[model samples]
Target: MSLTDNKSAGEELLLSRHSVRKYEPGVTIPEAELNEILELAASAPSSWNLQHWRFLVVTEQANKEKLLPIAYNQQQVVDASVVVIVLGDLQANEVAPKVYESATPQIRDMMLGQINGAYSNNPGLARDEAIRNGSLAAMQLMLAARAKGYDTVPMGGYNQAALIQELNIPDRYVPIMMLPIGKAQAPARATERLPLEDQVIRERF
Candidate 1:
């Protein structure tokens, strides 16, 4: 397809995506198919390509029940096929070797030095990178699921401390958001957005 055609297709996909909160209960997405979606999500860009994100997939009914209370009794937790806990890795630089495994030793070492230096100099940068890069993967994850005929909604209402404890999340990672994906029980709610002219920014505001 031509570039314009590709752009139209992209717009179509964006338009078709909407947050779905009511999923059909007991509708399971096969692990293999879900993995395909996850693989695509992992391709999202990261600072220094350290890939500072980890997915906690909650698929068992018992686990979902345990999560429901922490999420304020949101029914989507139990009804959705899977609830993904997107975690940001605060120690992403530790994976520098793996991220640049294909590069020459000298190049890899230099990149690792840069990654480690920036993070160590400013301790808060690790947290910021984790959240920012993890969020990019999360958005791609949602889009990939949608392209495969699944519905999802991004939720941030859960109790963070309880989630970490319940899921046994390690200290090195921070919980980013909870995303529930499955077949929707009903069509998603139609939404509107501000016009481009009103929302876009110009140079120097």
Candidate 2:
């Protein structure tokens, strides 16, 4: 079910989202609309207000075909209008100064100091924050696509090392996941979720 101008933002988009693995071939998403979806996804919150995600949009058919094998021969990778590779910036703290630039000098310096201290002292935490923040943006991206009447398949299965080498991804960024977005060839398969009683914790597990 495609969204319309009259349909307000609600369960229509959120509840309707499902992993769409098949897409109509050759359909194209205009750059302006694509940019809108991406900008909306970027509005997701991040640690220390430093957004840690980057996107690699693969729009050319030749490149998508090249990515197919690396994505385990997923046909959607070839047919989707675009394949967005979500990347996590491992050294996101480097942007703290800019993120807090509007603050007074004294406050900005204090924030920068705390950020540097934590990230520099704990490499593991830094890496965790990268993935954590990226995953948050990834979800928003998928939902944003749905709101735009597009489908998406959020994928984790891929040759990470090969993708990095093929894409020339920087060492400072971690490949988080791939999302193939396009017009669906068929409707997404229905999925069931665990009941709240079964999965939700009232307070603590």
Q: What CA root-mean-square deviation does each model show from the true structure?
A: 2.8, 3.3
Q: Name every residue pair that clashes in candidate 2.
A: none
Per-residue CA lDDT of candidate 2, range 1-205, in tens? Answer: 5434456667667877899988999999999999999999999999998899998999999999999899989899999999999999999999998999899999999999999999989859878999999999999999999999999989999999989998999999999999999999998888887876998788786
lDDT of 1 at 183: 97
RMSD of 1: 2.8
In terms of TM-score, how similar is model 1 to the real structure?
Answer: 0.94
User: How many pairs collide in each candidate, listed in order?
Assistant: 0, 0
- In candidate 2, position 79 carries an lDDT of 97
| Off by more than 4 A, model 1 | 1-7
- Cα deviation at 52, candidate 1, in Å, is 0.8
